[model samples]
Target: MKTTNLLMSMVIATTLFFVGCKPKDAAIQAAVQAKEATGITVAVTKGDVTLTGEVADEAAKAKAEEVAKAEKGVKTVINSLTVKPAPLPVVISEDPTLSKNVIDAVKDFPMVKATVKDGVVTLTGEIKKPALITLMQHLNALKPKKIENKLTVK
Candidate 1:
């Protein structure tokens, strides 16, 4: 009976020791997350921290990792943050303004006829080889949605 009681006592003591030694993952995660910048997500499991989310730049990504590493009870830091892509510039000229500009651009090349619809300039007719380049450059400067060059170069 005494031997069985001692074995049970040992088992309970071992369990308590391990439980006390283990770090609180939730508390560590909350601490690290509070220190990090917006858009950063912090996850902690078994004292290992994983950072995930989109940051503005490389510096922000590094900063988030640093924050996680600085938190107590964090044994390892896994950085999985991604940098956000830059947005493309939008340039679309109004149809009326583009039409006026197209008319002026083709005026010097009388043989070339220009038509504008929905910010698209369509060129149909005949134009000198040398004048075609100049007319195209002028139309491109107006930032139309598209340009259809059907002019016959003579």
Candidate 2:
């Protein structure tokens, strides 16, 4: 009977050791899998994982944290993932309508010159901060192929 008790105690100790000891690499691997979506980045320090970078939205950020927490050895998760603002879609188009819109949009701003070519928009000259921001929003909606942003913001 005493032998059986000693054997049982040894088994329990072994189990506890395995359960409590978790490796850092294993946690890092789990963090990688968790941050697969978007541009989220992970850092592991002493079983505490910190997630950083910008994601598409809040849900993506939350998912990353949840994944880190679910890992075997992660004692805490510090999710600092920020949601990036949506930008205008860049569609390639050589349509002359883009030029017309750009002209009409920034006609009052004499310091700016815009040229459209092969679906790409090139802006040159100096532009005021307020107008430049507004013009960009309008230009983005036009969905040009690429923007050669040479316009100096003042």
Maximum-TM-score candidate: 1
lDDT of 1 at 127: 83
What would the per-residue lDDT of candidate 1 be over residues 34-138, giving only the tens digit for each residue? 999988888998999999999999988988888788887999999999999988898999998889988888889878898999988999999888788888889
In model 1, which residue pairs have backbone atoms overlapping below 3 Å?
A: none
Off by over 4 Å in 2: 1-20, 25-27, 88-154
Q: Top lDDT: which candidate number?
A: 1
Worst 10 residues of 2 by lDDT: 26-35
The lDDT values for all models are: 0.90, 0.81
- Candidate 2 lDDT at 28 equals 69
Residue-level lDDT tens digits of model 2 in 16-99: 898677576655666565546757677778878888888888898888788888877778988888888999875555568878
Candidate 1 Cα errors over 4 Å, as ranges: 1-21, 92-97, 100-154
